[model samples]
Each structure stands twice: as C-alpha cells, then as structure tokens.
Target chain A: MRATEMTPNDKTNDSTEQKIFDAAHELFVQKGLDGAKMQEIADRAGINKALLHYYYRTKDKLYEMVAKSIIHQGIPIIQKTIESDLPLEEKIIKFVDFYIDLIRRNPFIPLFIISEMNKHPEQFIEKILPARLPRPEIFLKQVEDAVAAGTIRPVNPQHLLLNIISLCVFPFVARPIMQMVLGMQKTEADQFLKQRKTEVTEFIFAALRPR
Target chain B: MRATEMTPNDKTNDSTEQKIFDAAHELFVQKGLDGAKMQEIADRAGINKALLHYYYRTKDKLYEMVAKSIIHQGIPIIQKTIESDLPLEEKIIKFVDFYIDLIRRNPFIPLFIISEMNKHPEQFIEKILPARLPRPEIFLKQVEDAVAAGTIRPVNPQHLLLNIISLCVFPFVARPIMQMVLGMQKTEADQFLKQRKTEVTEFIFAALRPR
Candidate 1:
C-alpha cells in the first residue's frame, strides 16, 4: 500500500468530502456493498453517521459515485488516446502505457470494477460504457484506416478493442490469482505490469501485422 | 440451452457423479459461496443435506468439487490445444471454437471461477491451478514455430494467452452489462456469442499475421 501524497489544498468543504470518499472507498473495496456498513464508513471517515448520510444520502448513491470516480481513472485517458489522431501502433502503445500507469496509481480499481460489475452489471454499465464512454469511434475509424492502408490484416473494430482491453486488464483483474501463478510480490507485480506496457503493444502489433 | 447427449453404456458412474455435480452446481452458481447453504444443495439434489456432506464433507470441499467439475468444461481442452502439434492457425481456431461452445454450455463457469477465486484466491488457485494451467512454454513454442514457419508474427505467449482468456471470458463476466448495453435478452446474447465465435478466430489470426 503506497501512501498517497496528502496535500492540504483542502477547503473546509473539499476536506470533508474527501474524507468521506476516502473512508467509503476503503470500506467498499474491502467489504463490498452487502458487507460494508454505513456506520463503519462514518467511523473510518472520523465523522458522524449523520454527516455521512447528509453528504452521500444513501449507500447506493455513495457506491454510484465511487464506481463512476473509479471508472474515470482509466476510461477518460483511454478515450482520449483512442480519439487521438496517432497511428495505429502508437495508439496501442499509448493505451497500454496509460493503463499500466493507472493500475499502478490505484491497484484496486480493476477488481473493484469487475466485482461490482458482477453484482449489478446492468446498472453499472448503463451508467458508463466503453462504447458510449468517450471516443471509441475514433479507435474504430483508426482500425478501419489501418486495414485499408494494409498496415494490418483485416479485423473487426470490436475484436481490436477487446484484444487491447483484455491484454491490459486481465493481469490486474486476476491479480490475486496472478500473484500466485507468477510468484510475484506486490512490488514485483507493479514492475511486471510496467514492463508489460511495452510487451503488450509489441505483441499486439506482431499479431496484427500483415502476413 | 442445448440438450446433453448420452449413451446408456456411457452413463454408468458418470451420470451418477454428474447428477450430484449438476445439482450441486446449480446451487453454487445461483447462490455463491457464502450465500449457498448445504441444505439447499441437498434439497435441490432431492436428498438430505447429510447425504450431501457424505459426498463432499465441508462447504469449501463442496465448492472445490463443483469448481473442478466446472473447469473441466473447457480448460483441459485448451491446455491440450496449446500443447498440440497442430499449426498455430488451426490451434487458434480450435481454441476459439472450444471456448465459445464451452461458455455457451456453461455460462456461469467464468463468473463462478472469478468470484470464488476472488474470495480465496490462494486456496482456489492452489487447489485448482495445474502445475501449469495452460503453460506459457507450450504456447510460446507454438508461437516460435509459427514465427519460424512464417505463419505468424512474433508474440509473447503469456500476453497472448491472457488476451485469449479475456476475450472468451469478459463477455460472460460482463453479461449483465452487455445485455443492457446492446439492449439484448438471453437469446440475443447467445446469438451474439455465437457470431463472435466464428469471427473472433479470424480477427485474432488477422491481427497475428505479419505486416
């Protein structure tokens, strides 16, 4: 567990809100929705339960906020990279690099997303989807262009999209299982992913290159 | 859902074990580890919970038996494909076809593995993960052969393996989300997966071909 740099740019309002979110996120990650209690969140925040409810209103609302916030960690950057006018190869490099860094920053996000998504996927995906997420069309168009230019063999945009996502996300999503399989400690896993950023992009290009 | 085929001669101890497995599987899949009660499993089995315990002593034990039964749905076949002397292209087709059919028959397996593994990953993986569950060396050898034979481009076996698992598993892991995102029903999702089974192999092959 890395210590987050705690700066005091905190206005009174922002400080309280940050405290609440910090506490809530920790509990949510550890205990999940059914198991985590409101009182525990308030206690962890060092605030009264009344105050916790005053800010977040309900557990579902608090969770929705957390899910949306966590999803934003990787989603916006991936969207921006996808929308960028970069070449197909560079796009792959940038996306994987961005994700490796994001996972490094918040180690819990992928598992949190998958577990919660498992619990109520319809509600979660409706709130945010990769298709409606940001700039996937840009990515789809790039793949189409790459195939047209004979830079790669023909592929569906969805397959291209899923391939990138799976390669980048699976190690993290299955980190617990991976830690055992790879015989990696937490620090080593971080290093592995950092190395994997480049490894994945090269692998993707190798697979997609014209025969 | 498809009807399972059987011959009377083939249905000896296989069907008896299969009956217990089928009954136990329904309970575990629908209810999850902690949520599933032994009495419920036995009741579903049309026997006493004591009888259930006689077959599999502890709750964790039952979960493992069920998990092992489910993993046999596809993984051994995948490992076999990775180790086969077939060309990499045929191997990819074999794998994709296997996974699509595997998931189609047992939609709950991936979620079951992930969720149970999430709860006690070390135990689950230790109990279930083979000395190598789809070893990299085998896949790497195949990739090396393909690259050597000019059938495919260079790639890391590990990254490709992870990507392949993700493509096959994520759709089901995100089934509830996909159902909503595509405005799909069970039938629609089935059709969607069926379509992907055919196209996914081609897409991956296209991606793997040399530039």
Candidate 2:
C-alpha cells in the first residue's frame, strides 16, 4: 500500500512517477541497491536524470520505494485472504493460490530481499515491515475455532501457518537446487508449481482433517 | 570430502592444505568467490601465497573445492538418513531434526548456495549436483508402501517431499523476513527452531496418519 500510496497529486505526475518506479523496480531487483545506478534507472525510465531525481531524490529512497512496493503487492494479499470470512479450507486454498502465483510472477523478490536485508537489516527489521505488517492472529483464531468445532484436529496455528508459508515459498527460493535434484527444466518446474496449487491445499487439508 | 580431498601425500602437506582450505572456506563464504582474495586467504591461514597457490592453483579451483566440501558435508547426511531402515514416522523425524540442525549450524550455506548457483548455474547444475545427488525414490517408495499398507492416506510422495523440505528449509532461507514478522530476537529465533523439530515432524505425521 505504501508503494502506490506515495503518489504525487496530479494525473501526469502520477504516470511519470509510476514510470520512474517501474524502472527502479526492475534495476533494483536485478542489480540490487548498491549495484544499481541512478543514471541507469533514468535511462530505463526514458526520463532525464533531473526529472527522476525530482521524483525520487536519492538512490536509497528509490530502493526503499521498490522494496515497499514489492512487499505491499505480495504480503497484503495473503493477509487479506487469510483474514477473509471464507471457511478454513477455502481460505487456505486461496492463500496458497495467491501466494504461489505472486511468487511465480515475482521470482526475484525473495533473493533480492534476502540480499538487501543482509545489506540493510536495520532498515527492513526496524522500519519497513514493522510499519504496516499484518499479524497471523486472524488465521490463528480461525484454526483454533476450526479445532474447537471439531472441523479439524487440534494443532498449533503458528506451526501450521509456518508450514503453509514454507511449502509455498521454498520451491521458488530454492529453485536451482530443487531443479537439479528433481531433474526439472523450467517448463517442468512451472508444471510442478501448477500442480502445487491443488497439491499444497489438499496436503494441508489432509493433515488437518480429524482422525 | 572434496574440500579436503586435494592434498599431497605428506602429513605436513595435508595439514597445510587443510589450513589453506579452512581459510578459503571462511573467506569464500563471507566474500564469495569473486570477492575473495588469495592473499587474504594466505594471511588468514598464516601461510604464504606460494603455498596457497600450490594447493589450490586458483580461486575457481578453491571455490569448487569449498562448494563440494559444503554440499558433501550438508546434503549427503540427509540422503543417508532417509535411506536408512527407520520406520516412516521416525525417518521423517530424523530428517526434520537433522535438517533444521544443519541449517542452524551452517546458516550461511543456503544463501551462499543460492547466490553462487545463480552466478555459476552451469557449474552447479551440469557438473556438481549430478555427481552424487540423492534421488527421492527411496522416500517416495516409502510413502507408497505406507499408503498400500493403510498406515497413511494416499499422497503424491514428490509433493510430500517438497512440502517437508520447504517446511524445513524456508525458515532459514527467509529468516530475516520471518524474524521481523514474528518479532523474534536472536534467542527467540533459536527457541522457535528448537520447537519446529517436533512441531514439523508431528504436523507431517498428523497429515500422514490413515483416516
């Protein structure tokens, strides 16, 4: 939200600002904050250096915008899905579906974040995530209620959430290693992920089904 | 094995080779292959540059040795553990236990591998992993047997293995983000991992248990 939220208040200003942002996002994800140059971002955006600077004054500012943009686009969807009023099974399917789709679309986000976090831990830990991050409590309560109603076996919601996240995220993060180990090419890897939408949902459902 | 494999016949030669290797390992991990320097490694090992070169010949050779050493140390342990004659539940537990412990002790390995693999995919995919990487067939067959015996519900073993691995590995790979989300300090993160050894194994068992 903060990503799109930081907009100038005019129609042309918004489009130019967005172009600058789009260019920054590509470069930052590919080359990282330290490796990316402001001049390169300007050229990529088809804007002059003065105009790019006018929009986002510093490289760090642009990098922060890109990070916030990515996290905003990705994490909130899961939080909103998890917090929705759908039944537990449907809610979880949606979560896995959206989370996997997001990762598939933005495969670079994880490595970029990990690399940047190592470079700027205090910024990520102290500033960005803490600002508007969603809590897992809503999903936790849902799990607890499901168990209380005997719709599912009693389980720790934290562990379950962590499991769901791990399943969805790890394949993307460890793709190279997993690809080598599984003997999957890129097309095969995509097919595997397609199957995972249902595979992961059912896997969790089977685990949670009462004895 | 490969990390310390390229050694001369003499004991003194072996120790010096190992010392050079130990120094190379630390530097390559911290600075990566491109960033690491032979002189720094020599300095770190308390050996002369001539000796380091005599052992490794070049940084690439040293990097290959380090990567092999790490993969050799880290991965085969899991493969050997899974292939042992333990029952399904116990085998899964051993996996989660050994895996989480391995990542905990060698926190840099995942990030380093991912980064290095990105840098040198041809080497890793074409050369390294193919040499002795474990197949998931044993685990897959074990799951099939469990299902046929009515000890567990029918499941795709590949998906199951991927889920199990994702649960175990993602926490370490995405620690910074997870740590911020969970609001955990270093000690709490360690405590959380300790709990996951049990939590993940049981979570999987609960899913696998026959209806």
Query: Any idea what lDDT model 1 has?
Result: 0.70
Q: Write the per-residue lDDT of candidate 1 for residues A1-211, one digit (tens) a residue.
A: 1112334455365577778988888888655666578999999999999877776777888877776777776777866887888987877888888877887687667666666676666767676444565546677888898889888877776657766776777677676656664467988776776777777777677667676
Which ranges in model 2 have alpha carbons more than 4 Å from their true place? A1-24, A34-59, A85-87, A126-130, B1-24, B27-61, B84-87, B126-130
Measured against the true two-chain complex, the DockQ scores of the candidates, in the order shown, are 0.33, 0.49
lDDT winner among the candidates? 2
Q: What are the root-mean-square deviations of the candidates from the true structure over C-alphas?
A: 7.0, 4.9
Summarize candidate 2's per-residue lDDT along B1-211 as a digit string, tens digits: 2233445455474588878888999887765665578999999999899887777777777888888778788877888887777888888988889898998899878787886686567877665553777777778899999889998888888788888988888777777777767777889887887788788887888888777
For model 1, what is the alpha-carbon lDDT of residue A206?
A: 66
Candidate 1 regions with alpha-carbon error over 4 angstroms: A1-20, A35-58, A84-90, A122-132, A145-151, A179-189, B1-24, B34-65, B85-89, B126-136, B145-152, B175-189
Clashing pairs in 2: A207-B207
